[model samples]
Target chain A: MINAVGREIPDEILRMTGKEPFQGNSYKEGVPFRRYAPIIRPVMDNTHNKMVKDIHEALVKCKAHNGMTVSFHHHFREGDLVVCMVMEEIHKMGLKNITLAATSLGKAHDALVPMIEDGTITSIQASGVRGKIGEAISHGKLKNLAIMRSHGGRVRSLVTGETKVDIAFIGAPTADEYGNLRGVGGKSNCGVLSYSHVDGDCAEYVVAITDTLVPFPNFPAHISMTKVDCVCVVDAIGIPEKIATGAAKPTTDQRKLMMAEYCTQVVVNTPYFKDGFSYQTGVGGASIASTISLTKIMEERGIKMGFGVGGMTKPMCDLLDRGLCRVLLDTQAFDLDAVTNILNPKHHRITAGSYANPFNKGAFVNKLDYVILASLEVDVHFNCNVVVGSDGIITGAQGGHPDTAQGAKCTIVICPLLQGRIPAICSEVTTVTTPGESVDIVVTDYGVAVNPNRPDLLKALEEADCVPLKTIEQLRDEAYAITGVPNPVEFGDRIVGIIEARDGTIMDVVREIKD
Target chain B: MEILKPAVAGTLESSDCMVTVEPGQGKVNLDLDSSVMRQFGPQIKKVIAETLARLDVTDVNIRVVDKGALDCTIKARVEAAVYRSNDIRKDIPWGGAIK
Candidate 1:
C-alpha cells in the first residue's frame, strides 16, 4: 500500500508490524497513552547501595536472559566501547537472541557484526547504522527485521510500549556508586547524557556504566539514582577524542560557501528574520557553513536569535558566547567545545524526548524559524533519502531531520549538485525519509528550489532575488545531464528493515540486496 | 586513447570508486569488487566498459573497487586512470570520455 508520501509499504509488512501507513503529518490528533505500572523494585538491603562488581553481575542480578532486549546510547559516537564490552560479556555468559536497541550505532560497534551473524544478537532498533554492522543488517544476516526510527520516534516507541527495553546499559562519562550519572567531569566527557534519559526512565533494568566513579551524590546528576538500578565501572567509557572533537570547524569549500551564502540570504529575506528569531541546524559541513554565515548576517543587522537548539556544536556555542543567540537548548553535545560550553550558564541540556519528540506536548523544534540540514538524495518532489544510499544500503540516520523539517517555518536542505558522480537531486529518492510537504526549500551549489507548496517562500525569495533560484525539476535534470540516469537497484523479496517516520508510520522499507 | 601502463584513481570512501587501469592484450579484462555488488555490480561493470569504450580504449585491464559511486563518477575515474596510465596531459578528450 502506498503511504501518504507515495512510499510503497508491502501488505505483508503491514500485517507483520501492525503499523498503519503514514497518513500524512496530521494523522495523530488525540492523546497517546501507555498502560501505567508502578515500579516493582527489588527488595534491596540498602537502597543507596547499587554497585555491581562487573557487567556479569549486573546482567545476572537484572535477570537478563536470552531473547530479551538491551539498549545503548551513541553519545560517545565512534568512541563507544561499552556496547562491545557488554555484548562480549553477554556472549561469554551464553546469552543469545538478544535485541540491541540503540539510540544510534556507528563504526565503533562494527564488532557486533559477528555477534549478529552468530545469533547472539538477533535484532536491532536504532536511529542509524554504519560500517560492518550496516552491511550485516543490509545483507539480511540478522534474524529479525531491523527497525530504524528517528530520535523522536525511538522515544515514542519506548513510551508507547511498541518496543520494550529489558535492560538499558547507559555509558556515562561520570557516575557514582549509587548510580548518579553525568556526561561531563569524567576521563571521557561527552557532555550530555540526554539520549539515555528516556531509556533510564522506561527500561525495566537501568545500568549506568562508567569509567570515572565519583564520590557519593554526583551532584545535579543528569540521570538520577532514582531511575538507575545498578552501576558498573569499566576501564573506559569511550575514546575521548572520538567521542567529541577538540574543535568543530566550518566548511571552507568554495561551492559549499556559495550554498551557505544562499541559505543565509534566504533566512535574511524571510519574514522570521527579525531579532530574536529562532534557529536549528545539523552538524553537516554545509549546514555549519550556513550557521557561520548567519552569524555574520545577524551581526550586520544587530539581530540576536532567541534560541538555538539540536545537537550542540562549537559553532552554535560560539554564537551563544558572542551573544548572537540568547540560549542553546542542547540535546547532545557534538564536540569538546560544545561539551564544555554546554556546562555554562547560557547553555541548557535537554533530553532527546524534549528536543524533538513528535508526540510530546511541546518540542524545541516546533518553535524554530529556520533549520538547515543535509541530505544524501532529494527527489524533485522534495522527498529526501537520508537513510539509504543510491546502492540501497542504509548508511545514514534520520536524527531530527523530519521533526525539524515539519516544525520549522522554513527548512533548507543544503547540498552540492552531486556527491561524487551521484546526483544529489533525483526524480525519486530510494527511500522517502522526509516527505516533500514538510520540506520548504532545497538549496544546492548550483541553484535553489523552493517547494511549490510554499509559494510564500518563493515570493519572498523572488523579491529578495539575490540568489540563483531554479525549479527542482530543472536541478534534477541538470544533475542527470552530468551523471547519466542510474539503473534502479534490484532488491530481494525479504524486507530487511523498516524506516519509521516520527509518528510511528511506515515511511519506507529496505529490502535485502538482491544477488 | 589507450592505457599505456598501470595507473590508479579515486578512493575507497563512500560514494567514490577506486579504479586501476592497466594495458591489456587486445581485449578488455575487468576485475570488480563492490560493496553494492548484489544490486549494482553489473551496472558498475557496464559503466566502466562504456567509459573505456567512449575513450576508445579496449586493450585495458580495469580493476574497480566501487563504494557505490555514481555512473558519472565511475566514468570520470576511468578517464583519469586511462590518461594517467598513458601519461597524456594535453589535448585529452575529457568531456567526450565522460559522456
Candidate 2:
C-alpha cells in the first residue's frame, strides 16, 4: 500500500505488524484510545530492600527469560556502557530470543553484534541503529525485523502497550539506595533522564543502574523510587567526557553560513517570527549558525523568544543567558554547556513523552511556532530522510524530526545542495522520515523552496522579498547538473526495518542493502 | 599526445579525485575507486574515457581515486595528468586541450 508520502509500504508488513499505512499527518488526530497499564507488584512492606548485588542478580530478580522484551534509554549516547553490561549478563544466563527495545542505539552497542549472531537477541526496536549493529541488521543477521520509531513514536508505543517492555534497565547518573535517581550530581552526569521516564512508568519491572549511590532521598528525583523495582550499582554508567562534549563552535564554512543566512531570512520573513515565538533547532553547525544569525535579528528588533526547546546546545543556552529567550525546555543536553546550564532556574527539564509523544494530552512540539531541522536528504516532495544515508545504510536517527515537523507551524529544513558528490536535494529521498505535508520550507545554499502545500508561506516570502526563492525542482536540477544523477541504491527482498509515524502508522520500510 | 613518464594530478579531498597516468600495454586501461562508486561509478568512468579520448591518448594506464568529484573536476584532473606525463607545463592550452 502506498503511504501518504508516496512510499509503498508492503501489505505483508502491514498485516504482520497489524498497523495501517500512513494516511496523512493528522490521520490519528482526535482519535480516542485507552492507555495500557503495566501489571505491578506493589511494595507493601518497609523492610523490602530493592538493592541487588550486580547485573546478574538484577536480571534474576527481574526474572530473566527467553522471548521477553527489555528496554533501555540512550541518554549516555556514544559513551554508554550499561547496554553492553546488561546484555552480556543476559547472554551469559543463556537467555534466547530476547528483544532489545531501546530509545536509541549507537556505536557503543556494537559489541552486541556477536549476541545478535548467536541468537540471544532475535528482535530489535529503537529510534535508530548505527555502526556495526546497523550493518549486522542490514545484512539480515537478526532473526526478526527491526522496528525504528521516532522519539515520539517510541513513547506512543510504550503508552499504548503496543510494545510492552517486561523489564527496563535505566542507567542513572545518580541513584539512592531506595532507587531514587537523578541526572545530575554524579561523576558521569548527563544532565537529564527524560527518555527513560516512560520506561520507568510503563515497564513491568524497572532497574536503576548507577555508578554513584548517593544518600537516601536523592531529592527531586528524575525517576522516583516508587516506580523502581531494583537498584544495581556499577563502576561506571558512561564516560563523562564522551557523554557531553564542549560547546559547539560556530561554522566558518562559507556554504553553511550562506544557508544559515537564508534560514534566518526565512524565519524573519515568515509571519510566525513574532515576539514570544516558540522555536526548536538541532545542534548541527548550520543549525547553530542559524540560531546565531537569528539571535542577532532578535536582538536588533528587541524581540524575545517565548521559549527554546529540543536537544539543548550552547547557542540556545546562550540565548537564555543573554535574556533573548524567556525559557529553555530541554529534553536532552547536547553539550557540556547545556549540561552545566541546566542549573539555571529558567532552564527546565522535561520528559520525552511530554516533549514529543503524539498521543499525550499535548506535546511541547505542538506549541512550537518555528523549528529549523537538518536532513540527510530532501525530495522534491519536501519529504525528508534522516535515518538512512544515500548508501542505504541506517546511519542516523529520527530523533525529533518527524514529531517537531508535524507540530511546528513553520518547519524549515536547512541543508547544503550537495554532500560531496551526492545531491542532498533529489528527485526522491532514500526514505521518507518526515512527510511533506508537515514541511513548510527547504533552505539550501542554491536557493530556498517552499512546499506547495504552504502557498501562504510562499506568498509571505515573496511579499517580503528577503531571500532567493526557487522551485524545489529547480534546486534539484541545479544539483544534478553539477553531480550528475545518482543511481538507485541496490537492496535485497527482505525487509530490515520499519519506520513508524508518530501517530503509530507505517511510513516506510527499509530493505536489506544488497551485498 | 603521448605518455612520456608517470605523472599525477589532484588531491584526495572531499570534492576532488586523484588521477595517476603512466604508459600502458598498447591499450587504454582505467581503474577507479570512488566513495560514490555504487551510484556514479559508470558516469565517472565515462567522463575519464571521454576526456582521454579528446586528448587523443589511446594507450595509457590511469588510476583514479575519487572522493565524489564533479564531472568538471574529473575532466580537469584527467587532462592535467595527461599533460604532466609528458612534462608539458608551459605553453599549455588552457581551454583548447583542457576543454
Candidate 3:
C-alpha cells in the first residue's frame, strides 16, 4: 500500500499494525480525538513517606502483572539504568508479555536485549531504538510490530489514551519522601522530566524512582507529589557522566563549517529573519555550528530572537544569556550548560505535550520561525531519514524532527553530501522519517536545495546574492558522482518497526535486516 | 611522493578521526585504533589506502585513532596529513585529491 508520501507499505505490515497510512499533513484535520477518563483517587493522608525498599515492592503496590504496559523516560540518555532495572525485576517475577513504552532507548538499555529475545519483554514503543535492543527489534524479536513515535506524537497518544500505560516509572534526580520530584538537587541531575509528565497523568500507576531523597518538600518540583503514587529509592538512577556524554560542540571541519554558513545564509535571507523570530536546532556537529553562525548573524544584524525552543544546547543557551534570544523554552537539556540555564527564570522549562503536541491549541513549535535539523539521508523529494542507517538497521530516532519542521516557517536540513561511501543526498531516502512537505530547504557543503513545494524559500535564496542555490537532483547527482551509486539495502519480508507520523499515522516501516 | 617529516591532521573526537603519517620502511605499515573497529575497521583501512593511493604516496607509516568518522572525513584528514608532510600547501590539487 502506498502511503500519502508515496512510500510503499507492505500489505503484511498493514495487517499487522492495523494503522492507517500517512495521508499527508492536515489529513487528520477531521480526525476525532480519542476521549479518555482515568479513575481519580484522592490522597487521604499527608504521610510524606511513600518510600519502598525496592522496585519489587513498588511494582507490587502498583499491582504489576503480565500483559501490562510500563513506561520510562530517556532524559538520562545512554546512562539510564531504570529501564533495565525495572525490567529485570519484572523478568525475575516471571512476568511476560510486557510492553515497554519509553520516550527513547539507547545503549544503556542494551541489558533488555535478552529480555526481548526470551519473551520477557514483548512489545516496544519509543522514539529511539539503538544498540542491542535495536538489533533485536530489527531481527523481529518482539511478537508485535514495534511502534515508533516522535516526542510530540508519543505525548499526544498517551494524553489521548490511545495507548494506555499501566505503569509509568519515572526516574527523578531528586525527590522527597512524599514524592515531589525535581530533576536537579540530586546525585544524578538531568535537566527536566518533561517527557514523563504525560505518563504521570495517563498511567494507572505512577512510580517515582530516585537516588537522592530530599526533605519533606522538594521545592520547585517538576512532578508534584499529587501525581506520584509510590516512590522507590535506588542507589543510582543513572551514570551522570554518560547521561550527557555526547553534548555536541561546534565543528572545526571546514566542510561542516561551510554547510553551517550556508544554513545561516538561508535564515538571514528569509523573510522571517526579522526581530522576534523563533528558532530551534538539534545536537550535531553541523547543527551546532549552524546555531553558532545563526546567532552571529543575528547579532550582526542587531535583531533579537523572540524565543528558542526544543532540546536546549550550550550554544542556544549562550544566545539566551547574551540577550540575542529573549527566552529559551527548554524541553530537554542536552548538556550541563543547558541544565544550569534551566535554573534561571529566563529559561523556562516546558512539558513535552506543550512543546509539540499537534492536537494542542498552542505548541512552542507552532511559533517557530526557523528550525535546523540533522539527517542521515535526504532524498530528491526532500524526505529525510533519521531512523534507519545505510545497512537497513535501526540506529536513529525521530525525536522532534518532524514536529519542529512542520511547525517552523523555514525548516533547513544541514548535512554533508556524503557519509563515507554512502550519499547523504540520494534518489530516495532509506526511510521517510520526516515527510518532504514539511522540509523547506536542504543545505550541503556543495550547495543549497530548496524544496520545490517551498517556492517562497527558493525565491528568497535566489534573491540573496551570496546564497548558492541548486536543484535537489543536482545535489543528489553531485553526491553520486563523488561516492558512486550505493548498493540498495537488502531487507527481509518481516516488518520489525513501524514509523508513526506526528499525527499517529503510519509513515514508514523498517523490515528485518538480512544476515 | 616522499614525506619530509612527521605530520598530523584531524582531531580525536566523536565522528572524527586523527591521522598521523611518518616515513617508514619499504612497506606501508598501518596502525589503526578505532572505537568502531569491530564494525568499520576494514572500511576505515580501505579508505586510508584509497586516500594514500589518490595522493600517489606509499611506503609510509600511518596511524589512525578513529572515533567513528565517515569515509569523506577520513579521506580529507588523510589528504591533509599527506599534504602537510610534503609541505605542499600552495597550488594543492584539491579536485584530484578530494575525488
Report RMSD (Å) for each prediction in the order shown: 3.0, 1.4, 5.6
* lDDT of each residue in A408-454, candidate 3, tens digit only: 98999997887755689999898899999999999998999999988
| DockQ, 0 to 1 scale, candidate 3 | 0.08
Stretches of candidate 3 above 4 Å error? A46-49, B1-99
| TM-score on alpha carbons, each prediction | 0.92, 0.97, 0.86
Per-residue lDDT, model 2, residue A201, is 84
lDDT of 2 by residue, A327-351 (tens): 9999998998998899999999999
lDDT for each residue of candidate 1 in A305-381, tens digit (9 for 90 to 100): 99999888888999999989899999888888898997679999999989888877878888999999889999998
Pitting candidate 1 against candidate 2, the one with the higher DockQ is 2
User: Candidate 2: where are CA atoms >4 Å away?
Assistant: none
DockQ, prediction 1: 0.36
Q: Residue A215 in model 3: shift from native, Å?
A: 1.4
Query: What share of the reference contacts is kept in model 2?
Result: 0.82
TM-score of chain A of 2: 0.99
Taking the candidates in order, what DockQ does each have? 0.36, 0.83, 0.08
Ten contiguous residues minimizing lDDT sum, candidate 1 chain A: A34-43
- In candidate 2, which residue pairs clash? none
Error of 1 at A253 (Å): 1.3
Q: Which candidate achieves the best DockQ against the true structure?
A: 2
